[model samples]
Target: MPPYILPFEKPILDMEKKLEDLRAFSQAQNIDVSFEIERMQNKITEMRREIYENLGAWDKVLVARHPQRPYMLDYLAAMTTDFTELHGDRVHADDRAIIGGFGWLEGRRVMFIGTQKGRDTKSNLERNFGCAYPEGYRKALRLMKLAAKFGAPIVTLIDTPGAYPGIESEERHIAEAIAVNLRDMFRLPVPIVVVVIGEGGSGGALGIGVGDRVLILEYSYYSVISPEGCAAILWKNRSYANRAAEALKLTAPDLLKAGLVDEVLPEPPGGAHADPAAMSATLKAALLRNLEELDATPVEQLLEQRYNKFRAMGVFGEDAAPAPAASPAPAS
Candidate 1:
């Protein structure tokens, strides 16, 4: 199959095609075209670097949603060992969209939870395109609670467009479920690490997003809503998604500047999809480093810091007059 191409990737893709044809001709003719091939390869590398260096927020969104970008399972496979998946919320049916289980990460057993999107039509249908329902959140919370009980650290991978918006999802109380996760996660005694691995959209992402340290991939985006959804609401036209993406301040660099993310893990050139193994290695190292730091802190202090970290989000204006200083205490 032809490699999936994004709108902004046309130039690179065209060059790649030419390179492929050149290689084929060179092989067919038994010709010595090594010099030309090397030159073209260097040019392609330079072009990719130029294109990725100055991407706008909207361009980052496109990279975050790239078809071949590594997802939760890919990271799990690369970073964890002795995996064991746990299913169901017990009170409701199991949700395929959000998966959680036990895994060993760098010699420490941890609970792994993440939104899972599929690669093809049938799989996407089954996974609901990574949009979770109430049960999914509940399942995630269940795993979180289990991690705390076992004194295991938790690692959550976020990648979702949003929670499922169907009437059935509402009826099942999706909002309440996510709210409960947000609340309970704050109180969990074990260290928790959250990573925005792809399109972290709305409550679906937040359901498993709260943690002691929140990391975002270089090309990933995390926002209260998807760009398309924001465009529809603000402009009544989804075509304005590019504008919405810029306005949302959802890119990794933006969030890092705003102090919303603890760290931004760099992706390989051309984005994570271009080199997933390298991306995974970098992510695993970051996770282990942060987890070790958190593990060394007292549980009470960790919880307090986690609470304070989230409380500090959003803009807050200074008190208008600094509340006039208390009148000089009575001398008498």
Candidate 2:
């Protein structure tokens, strides 16, 4: 029902509809097209593989921001148990943009943090379209501290256009909140995992994004700024965002190759929106694998690893470390 569905999605949906109709026809008329159904199913699988294999960076960005793409709440509903939501920054009113809670995922006690955009018109307005204010970032900092204090591993879901840049947010010290999160995140003692489930825009995304390991969904993007903002600043033309997106190196594959993210979890064919359950399953497995590796690490080691992971990214000039050689060393 969302507007951004790719052209390929239509035929896939049409084939599925036909299959459903055939099932109904068989029940009603006592006719069997079992062989025909199997053939059509194979065709669907082939089409899906082709479509998923060739998604461009821009297409991936659009898929990441798809209106129907599953958000943090969807993941929580599907994967977590006994979710106890925590609220407020203690110094200010609670922010809905960042949702924090203690929850159990696959029998592991963990703290969940994420930016939440509203799904519909009214909820979107209520959530400020996932744009965090200073209070939201501050609240996230508080939750991260709680997770560390309780020794619970943290799982953060990033999905936002950016932090709110309105007058009220400035009054509350937006930059200060984000800076504090980044500064404190490096010192936290537990395993921290960040997943860019959708748009990872600027400090807003990074406010809760610092972690021991970062994973991006197949179609998601992690960028220092939005493509439109980058275009306006660089060329003074907003229409050049597509070009900026290409040059920004913001897609999952680009970031992976650049060594900015730890892993890229594949999404379902036609993007996560086309098959949320499958996407969630894939993400859960990735999360579990990362958590398993991070769980046994001591708090001090976790902090050190996280600090080094971020500190090593984007160093410039003579201070930058040499990249690994094209061919790996021969086994001893």
The model with the greatest lDDT is: 1
lDDT of each: 0.93, 0.88
For model 1, name the residue pairs that clash.
none
TM-score of model 2 (CA atoms)? 0.89
Instruction: Report the CA-based lDDT of candidate 2 relative to the real structure.
Output: 0.88
TM-score of each: 0.95, 0.89
Q: Residue 198's C-alpha lDDT in candidate 2? A: 97
What shift in Å separates residue 263 of candidate 2 from its native position after superposition? 0.7
Model 1 local distance difference test score: 0.93
TM-score of 1: 0.95
Best by TM-score: 1
- The candidate 1 region of ten consecutive residues with least summed lDDT is 321-330
- Per-residue lDDT of 243-288 in model 2, one digit per residue for the tens? 8899899999999999999899988767788788998899888889
Give the 10-residue window scoring lowest on summed lDDT in candidate 2.
Answer: 1-10
Per-residue accuracy of model 1 over 150-218 as CA lDDT, tens digit each: 999999999899999999998999999999999999999999999999999988899899999999999
